[model samples]
Target chain A: MITLHDIGFSYGNNHVLHDITTDFHPGEIVGIIGPSGAGKTTLLRILLGELTPTQGRINNSSSANIAVGYVPQLDSGERTFPLTVEEMVLLGAAAFSRKKPWFDQSEKREASRILERLGILQLRNNRLSELSGGQFQRALIARALMSRPSLLLLDEPTSGIDLHTRQQVLDLVHELQTDGFTIILTTHDLNWVAAQLPRILCLNGTVTGDGAPSEVLTSQVVRETYGANMDVIFHQGRPVVVDSVNNGGNQ
Target chain B: MSYFTDPFQYDFFSRALIVSVLIGALAGAIGPFVLVRRMAYIGQGMSQSILGGVALGVVWGLDLYFGAAVAAGLSAALIYFVRNRGVPVDTAIGIVASTLFAIGVAVVSSSRDRRLNSANLLFGNVLGVDTEDIILVALVTVIAAIVLFRNYKTLLAVTHNSAVAAAHGVRARLMEVIFSALLAMVVVTALRVLGVLLVAATLLIPAATATMTFRTFRNITIASICLGTSFAIIGLFLSFHRNIASGPAIVLVGATVFAMNMLTSTTSQRNRA
Candidate 1:
């Protein structure tokens, strides 16, 4: 379990996150939903220890060493970086072994296994530029898994892909969560988050609402967070979100 | 061919060939990082700033290479410092490089030394290379090879995405500084053979060509080294036979290779489409 207490961050005089307190348990999937500039990426950076909060305390209860794996947003620059899928995945393992400058055969086998697990084994030798959006996402997931982290963080994994690919990626994340990996992902797709994720945290520079989708994803809460009117409907006991203006009329 | 063997008849020609090959390989190995990191302009800035150091050395009666190394290193450090202070990289590099280059020109104009040939310094004379220059180039080549070989993965990580690398416990700032310093060393060492006007081309063209022809980093690195060394040898041959300046000849050969690579890659990409 990891706990964040009163996490507040600022860049110079502009405060980004304020009084953010959250606890992440083992084997749970959490979705962070917010509009742009709501500090979603900033909060993820703080969790990954890339940025230190101005006022906060974090406690990790796991006895073993805590290793966190991060998957950043899709970067077009990395696609043309002249590295094969296998070599890119091996970079994740490089972070683990400090003494070995190059990956050994054992690390190669591990990378192959992760690629297999991610269902991209056939693309091991293919360059990153050759992979489609869905395949690239899978490859990035395999790279993150190379570290064997207890916590996995993904930032906007389904932003640019098609609807079918988005559903496939969400299914993969669900499978990982079922396999006992704690996952936290940020997204603006509230409908997908409500339908696929177990818990959602609505954020606008702070935690506006946090609970199961049915309890926290109300129309008023979403409007407060996103500054846009959204309609919330319960479809078979699960909240289904829709844009109020685009779907004909207000609720 | 007798054309190739004719240049090897003279000891000076052989030494110039050896120095060119060494510097070519070293610059080729280091060039990809500069290209991938989008620091090609920084390489240009460092090379141009070396003129200031050489001019200062001429005025003070000191070793010009040492002066160049100091000036280039200081400019690199200043660029790094300014980048951290929220200045954009291209703007900072421009400000520093032009200032140093202007100072170098001013110092050269005021100097009383009759033997300080600015044209020869700006455009290299391969035949003027001595044994000491060869040794220095060889030493720097070996050191650069070792440093790049040992830190290949770390450097790749930082180049790919610095924020992600930092998240994974890699010190991105330290790696940036180390790479900048290495770039400075290469620029300073390469000045004797390629000169300020052409060294940046030597550092960028081969790497750019390799990127067009290869799909993997290791292949790109190897291909860049081969291409750079070949251009150096061929350029030296042309210089010896055609009575042309060596630095321009080398840059021209590299440019031709880059054009060929671009043409072929475009055709292949069209075929794939």
Candidate 2:
């Protein structure tokens, strides 16, 4: 389990994250929904132990000793880095045990397994720079899985991709969740997440509400957190958020 | 034939050529890391700072090699320290190197010993590569090569992305220190052959030239070493006949090679386009 208690983080004079207290247990996918600049990234960083909180404490249970695989949002762009997909994934393995001289047969097999699972085994030898939006997201996920971490922290993984690709990526995340990986991903894809993920954390600087998709993504919570007036439409027993403000429809 | 045979048969000349090649190989290998990390300027800065150490040695009548080594090591440590303290690595490097270089120039200007020319320190005396200097450069080159080989993957990961490397459990700060130290070692060893001002070019140019031709990491390294050694040998011969500065000669050869490699790559890219 990953736990944070009363975590307050400040950068210089500005408070980025304030009084965050929560424990994320295993076998459940927690989706954090908030507007931009709402400290969702900072909160994720704090959980990953990448950023030390100015106030409060963090504790990790013995089970979650694996490195928290973080897929950052900002740095990755259309531009390509001079590395292969296999090389990128091998970098994740470099964290655990870099004592071996080379990536042996077993390590190569493991990397291939992850690539196959992510449906990008064919692109294993391809350069990372050549991948499209959805392909790159899947590659990043495969790279993260190379470490075999218990908890995966994805920061806006579905941001720049299109609608069909977004659904496919979220479906993959859902599959991973069902296969028992504690996943916490920050995303602006509220409607998509609401339709798929069971639990939700509606946050804006602080947790506005936390419960099932139905309880957390209400009209009042949406307005308070995102400044968005939207209605949750039940389509075939699934929650689909329809933005009345942006869609130019009668509320 | 007497001039050719005598120099070739002599132990000193053989040692000189071997040492120069070794130094070139070491600089070429470590240089790609420097280029990729965007610390090419640091190599130049550190090389120039070695003049301060040499000037100090001249003033105090101490061993110049030892003095240059100390200076390079200290400057490297300072760069590492500043970087660890969250200062920009390039800023720290620029400050330390330029400051020491200025001090060296000032000290030399004020000194009464008119015999030692600063121009020699800036260029090089490749013909004066004695047996002792050759052995010293060779030993250091071996050590640098071994260190680089041992931590190859870790260094690659660290250079590629520090934050990701850190998250993956690589000691990013420690790797930075190691890389800086290796650079210093290569600079100090190649100081006599390339001189302080132009040593960084020797480190940077050959590696950069090879990168344009080679696509993979392994090939880039091998191609860089070949380019470096070829330039060193040919530059030594040309400088011997033309009576030009060996440092500038070597750099010019590297530049020519770099231009050729770049042209070839551009043509190939255009062909594909």
List, residue by residue over A1-251, the lDDT tens digit for candidate 1: 99999999999999999999999999999999999999999999999988899998888897776787788999899888888999888877655555435788888999999899888999999999999999999988887888777789999998999999999899999999998999999998888889888899899999999999989988889878887788888999999877685654433
The model with the greatest TM-score is 1
- Give Cα-based local distance difference scores for all models: 0.86, 0.78
lDDT tens digits, residue span A1-251, model 2: 77778888999898977777887888789889898888898888777777899998988787436566766663553224555777777777775554543566788899999889989999877766678889888877876777677778888988988989888888888888878888999988788778778888878887787878876767778877777677777778777777775564433
Would candidate 1 be rated incorrect, acceptable, medium or high by CAPRI criteria? medium
**Worst 10-residue lDDT window, candidate 1 chain A:** A93-102
Question: Could you estimate the TM-score for every candidate?
Answer: 0.94, 0.87
Whose lDDT is greatest here?
1
Mind giving the per-residue lDDT tens digits that candidate 1 earns over B1-273? Answer: 999898888999988999999888988888888888877898899998889988888688898788999899888878878889999999999988998888888887777676456666777887668899888888888887788777777777788878777666667788887787678878888776788878889989999999887887878888998988999999999888998888898999999989987998889999999
Q: State the weakest 10-residue window (summed lDDT) of model 2 chain A.
A: A74-83
Candidate 2's docking class is acceptable
Error of 1 at B10 (Å): 3.6
